[model samples]
Target: MKKTISFITENFNKSSPDLVGGFQGFQRAINMEKEDIIQEIVLSGLKGRGGAKYPTGKKLMQSAEHHDKEKYIICNADEGEPGTFKDRELLLHDPYGVFEGMLIAAFAINASHGILYLREEYKYMIDDLKNALNHMRSLNLLGDRILKTELSFDISIFLGAGAYICGEETSLIESMEGKPGRPRIKPPYTLEKGLFSKPTLVNNVATFSTISAIIRNGYEEFIKYGTVESPGTKLISLCGNVNKPGAYEVPFGMTIREIIYDIGEGIRNGNSFKFAQIGGVSGPLVLPKHIDTPFSYEDLNEIGVPMGSGAIIVVDSDNDILDYLDAVQAFFKHESCGKCTPCREGNRQLLNILSRLREGKYSQEDTINIEKIAKTMKYASFCGLGQSAPAALLSAIEHCPQEIFKRRD
Candidate 1:
């Protein structure tokens, strides 16, 4: 297969370098100056790959601007989303990339401590990260004065119990603080009150990992890959009935068709493509009509969908859209912490309506009620999971109403 994206292609030259493979002596601190590092990251136009699309440099600058006697950096590696494994691949293949990124972030923000919070299920990555940490320590990369510079930083690995809600930044902080993973109300955001109620910056593994390339090559070089609004490459985990089902790093503006047909080598076994979920559960269900849509935050949002955690799940003609909706609803229902009544009750009611639809008990009235409940969940819920719970169901119903509304007589 011909590789079209430069992000993966450029990195492929190293192709699992020995330094990334638990070997010591690779310089943890590169020769690049700190100002150059910030400029490079700013030019790269990188955004958080965790789906929010927040500008990476801006985040670092915000933290840097607020540097105080105590500040912390956090790498969110809890890959709990269904069908998303891009972070796992990055951690397994290029653990040092993440470490290097975190170090740069720590330096930029003058943070004294860093932590990589990973899911316990990713045992391999956890072990790999530990090995990488040890390797860095042996070279005097992690402890005390790093690379003989005045900057001192250390990273600790915290294993999460694998709750999906912990993927939320504040919730991850709450989890690391030895509490149940429930998202806190924002406005005194993580940059202000996070991790032990101190100033902190929490970013995804991929977002931090990209820092290596930015610092190494310069921001203009990084900016060469993506569009104006969303610069830099994004790693997408392509799964579900695609010829190529692994993770691949592609430029941000690439079309869905390019990813599906070219990169994925077209649907598996000649099955006709039905639809695809651009993001995870929080993302909207994209139909055939939206195939040409550019894979960027703005583009997806303008079209009523959000480019979430970059999990591209392709569904074929054989798959039932309603069943998929049911599964998604079940996930939200099960994961709801029940702190809020609308989410707790709204999710259960949505599940029941889906069950009624599946059993042919749904009338037009039931469908109307389902829509109403979904709207309520969207506006009334406290956190993101609850607010976005209706994304899949709403998209499925909007795009494939016939499939959902079909009578069983």
Candidate 2:
């Protein structure tokens, strides 16, 4: 049984009164030269937790290279992934930790303003977040010249309208600009021309919180936790068929078996584990044979799966794989922004195929079409939404062909 790691959740038990005010990381960040701060983060090997797993230090260095006087930091709190709620827990329990991270980033990149782009589903948390901001302001942890340093930064919360596509950085930026939530074409990536066409640094809630931990504990201590290729801990939103379904923070090298059987207390009802979906709905399926695979970016990548959104949804043997595919396909179909042809049409066709398979009317042609469209979306889709929408379907077709397709007479 793997023990729960406590880097990020170390202060989960502390109340807001105890958690708020006096951010040592932010204090230390303000005093250091911006270049040194970026170097420290680069050395820490902290990657973005918003599914892409991009190097946080590299992104920060790029943003720093751009000498735009009006740089901005956007903390992506829009936890739109179906099974991922780790960000919500962070915002709910340790909001100040998030704020400190944003401040540290802002200072590192000379960003004057920060925006917390929160999802509408989490609207109930708006008031609490605002109050936390006010408290930070009162303590001089936020607003102009924070902690009496020359570095000045402020943060505001903008409510998202529950659109899944807005989880993409460009789409979120468009919505913030009062436009509809649709992804933009790349080459002016967020680091280049983001949020009002100014240089912006967009990072997820978990990424920011982890940044705070790295700063608080120093990069040396942070690197001691996880694997060489994937250092530090990840907060996983473990759900579905598991006895213990909740947010768990664990080191990167722990295997799926450890996470499921040990941390999650194994599959519910003693029914036996069928397969687990690591990451969110778009994440690829991990079969029983691969359950022992270490839960790290490099290892999962070796198996052609991504460490997306830190969501692990376990499935039991009793449930039909087609039914699960139906639900997942339906979500992607509904969430397709229709901005691009591949995603908008591909998801629709994918859902249609699932429906036919469920009714026992699907053909080998339908199966072929699923692969064709899934590959099309993976290669040609406009954004991450369209690109990753076919992950679960592809995994199913590859790993459980007997279960997903109908037998020919």
| Model 2 per-residue lDDT tens digits across residues 1-409 | 6699999877664634335434778767877888988999999999999989899999999999888888899999888898899999999988888888898998888888899999999999999899989988887777777767776888999999999999989999999999999988898788989999999999999999899888877899888989999999999999999999999999999999999999999888998888888778887788888888999999999988888898999999999998998898889989999999999999999888888888878787997898999999999998888888888889888888988887534
Task: Give the local distance difference test score of model 2.
Answer: 0.89
Error of 2 at 141 (Å): 1.3
Off by more than 4 A, model 2: 13-21, 407-409
RMSD of 2: 1.6
**Which pairs of residues clash in candidate 2, taking residues 3 or more apart in a chain or in different chains?**
none
Local error of candidate 1 at residue 196 (angstroms): 1.0
| Model 1: CA > 4 A from native | 1-36
Per-residue lDDT of model 1, residues 93-171, tens digit only: 7777777788887776788999988888887566667877887787766888887877788899998887889999988
Quote the lDDT for 40 in model 1.
Answer: 63
Q: Show the lowest summed lDDT stretch of 10 residues, model 2.
A: 13-22
- Evaluate all candidate structures by whole-model CA lDDT and list the values in order: 0.80, 0.89
